[model samples]
Target: MLAFAGAGLWLLLAGPADVLGIDSGNAGMVLLMTATWTALYQVGRLPPEDVVRVGSPAEWKAWIGTAFMAAAIAYFLTRGEVLAGVTVFNDPHAQRIGRNLVLLLVAWSVLSSVMASRWKGVVEQDERDREIAAQASGWGRGALVAVVIGLAVLLGLSPASRLAWASHLMIANLLIFALMWSCFVEYAATAAYYWRERRWQ
Candidate 1:
């Protein structure tokens, strides 16, 4: 939910609507993504377990790939030309990564759900899995909170002249980075736990 909504808003805020090339149905797609977000969020504010489908530890490890892919798409589309030297890409300030991020999140969510459901009724996960998840989630969320607080302090204490790059669009990017960083931390931690615990068997 956060992934989809945040990404969609990330693009829409870069709007004048026209700058997004919305005449090609990207606008409808963003609207659809937002509507889906609203619907999911409105469903009684469901518990995380109810909404987040879990698969085997191996499957969870695979999700790290999804997070990395989303991050790559965000970079290549928004700022790839910076390294690639192609005039076809023109997001110097990274105001457009959200469009790609939204698509990647939605696609990855659907794919992960379908994959997770393959284990339905068989009950693959055990208490150990849950323990790792709890621990990993704490690592992820704690890292996110700490980074956001650090950013707040940096922005608050720094002289305005030194912080001129922190525009509204850039702040949006920072929020996006924070979320992505958390997911990376969580997924990587989960994978690491599984790998380390495998020696116990």
Candidate 2:
């Protein structure tokens, strides 16, 4: 709850100015502070029951992967565009999104580390977990391959003279989106497997 609130507050305070290219320096600092505070609060204070409910190693991995990938997708979706000869970090909106994404990843890492430290010996992965992970990984790899092939075909078929069709930045973003989508699918599949296992047991 506190984590969510922190993220919402950060977005509310920094999102508009970032998108509009105003107050970049202070906005970045505010975002960092909010993220640090949120991460510490969540890591040190979240209930043990809530952490335990995350289940085995596989489930924990799935949850963390899903979260980070979801954040990445959100960041990329909100990031306006990359201009020629301009670094992504130079753009205010992109920098804001990047910072938020990094914050999310850091927060999740902190949470996961805390949970693992507290539950050290109890979170072992059984054969079932290994099997589910293998299956999920295969599905993720397949999805990634399919997406890459599709994108290659689309780009290859497009007319060279069309600016929108041939934008390197767009294509790069699409590839990143495809990768993130694959990761999300993998984590979702792993979570489903864990749910099914629990349901049957």
Whole-model Cα lDDT per candidate? 0.58, 0.65
Instruction: Mark the regions of model 2 whose C-alpha exceeds 4 Å error after superposition.
Output: 2-15, 18-54, 80-96, 106-111, 163-166
**What C-alpha lDDT does candidate 1 achieve relative to the native structure?**
0.58
Error of 1 at 18 (Å): 20
Write the residue-wise lDDT of candidate 2 on 11-130 in tens digits. Answer: 643355553664543454355446645664675475656666657766867865675566556656655443222344356555545566566556667666755675565646778888
Residue 136's C-alpha lDDT in candidate 1?
A: 87
- TM-score between candidate 2 and the true structure: 0.68
Q: What TM-score, to 2 decimals, does candidate 1 have?
A: 0.59
CA deviation > 4 Å runs, candidate 1: 1-95
RMSD of each: 10.7, 4.8
Tens-digit lDDT string for candidate 1 (157-178)? 9999886566665566567678
